[model samples]
Target: MKAIKVAILDLYDGHPNQGMRGFKEILDRYKAKHNLNLVYQVFDVRGKAEVPDLNFDAYISSGGPGSPVDSEGSVWEQRYWELIDKITACNQQADSVKKHVFFVCHSFQLMCRRLQLGEISLRHSPSFGVLPVHQTALGRQEVIFEGLHDPFYAVDSRSWQVTHPDEDNLKKYGAVLLAIEKERPYVDYPRAMMAIRFNDYFFGTQFHPEANPVGMKAHLINEEKKQQVISEHGERKYDEMIERLEDPGMIRLTQSTMIPNFLDQAILSMQEA
Candidate 1:
């Protein structure tokens, strides 16, 4: 049996987080269910400047805590970019089995900046809740988002957003803006890009697709986090999010779909090749 190698780039920078736990749960489930020879290794990209070599079938870069804008020219950022460059080069080859990548949250923000796909800037206020993201036309046809509701809910906690996409670069890279935050009819503000297909082998989401409702609810119920949500997003919003956590049609549906679907597609393609 051929081994399926996966590289997990940890960008959390030592902050305690549920994202890494979420990733582990999903990956473990998939590996067992498929009964495949799949192995994954973690590289602490931000904390230790550690990066994986171009010897893996797929890579998943995790979300982190910091400004994606301020990390430019840093050692870790440079090394990360170098890995991406190598992946891009390898994928461009006709004979090579292409490498797959999925960027989440903060990593998604950095990808937007790196690809010059959008303006990465601070939000008017922090967005911290399980919110609906409406899919674009291309997103509807996207394999990873297949069978997902047009307006699916996912956990979105970020101090920054990607807005005002550059049309030329998007076309140049053959990248499709997959999804966006729910439109505010009353506000004259640009909707943040919630997802983007960077290329055939590369995809990303601004929300945490690995965030299962049970885990999300657990995090929310933490006293400090509970107060933070109530203070920033409002008490009613916090209560509403709590209520929605158990809804089968909300974040649960999203968590079960996106990341798992991406893995299915990648694994199948690589195995077939």
Candidate 2:
């Protein structure tokens, strides 16, 4: 059995943290379950490294805290555009081979940056919490959602989002809003779309299904609770977060349910192609 060569694009700032580790965990778990030979590598775009051999089944753009569209001289923002352009070219050229792309958080913003639809502005960002997501017709039908239950839960800790892209605009941009929020919507941002599939091979998520319970709490809650933390990070109630993380049933269900389905769909797409 050959291992799936998976390239994980890490665009985080100086220090990479647990959320990044969790994504790798997702890949590791999938490999363990499916007898997959998985080659996972993280590329820190902050330095000089020509895009390594991208001869892989999939390319994943992991979530980061920075906005790729920011004018500030962030090497990551620059690198993102470079990578997307390359990916688009690969899709067009022969012998290059078309591959699947999975974008998380900042990576989603990178897609928007390429399409010129909208950049993630901090206009009305949602505070951290467990957000309920509703699947669109496309989402329900997409391979990423195949065999998954409806109203799937994902970890959303991002501030930037895909802004308003109407149907025509979305089609023009070559993307679709596969999933939306039902309850506890991020009204200000309202999560442009939880998932989008491009050309049947490339897809993205606004939420972090790669996130484990502990990772979720740290990314979603701890970061957002800056105000609370400034006044009372330790003092304020962290019991809810603790309960959510410690709950074996909840954690197991999340891990067992969503990501496996995603991995299966991705691998199937490669086989069928």
RMSD in order of candidates: 1.1, 4.0
Across 1-273, the per-residue lDDT of candidate 1 in tens digits comes to 888888999999999888998888888888898898889999999999999999898899999998999999999999999999999999898888888999999999999998899999898888888899999988888889887888889998899999998999999999999999999999888999999999989999999998978988988999999998888889999999999898999988887788889888788778667
Clash list (residue pairs), candidate 1: none
Q: What's the C-alpha lDDT at position 57 in model 2?
A: 67
TM-score for each predicted model, relative to the true structure: 0.97, 0.79
**TM-score, cand. 2:** 0.79
Over 4 Å off, model 1: none
Consecutive 10-residue window with the lowest summed lDDT within model 1: 264-273
Residue pair clashes in candidate 2 = 3-37, 4-37
Question: Which is the leading candidate under TM-score?
Answer: 1
Question: Across residues 187-249, which tens digit of lDDT does each residue of candidate 2 receive?
Answer: 443446667775556777777767788665665355555446334424333454455556655
Give the lDDT of residue 179 in candidate 1.
96
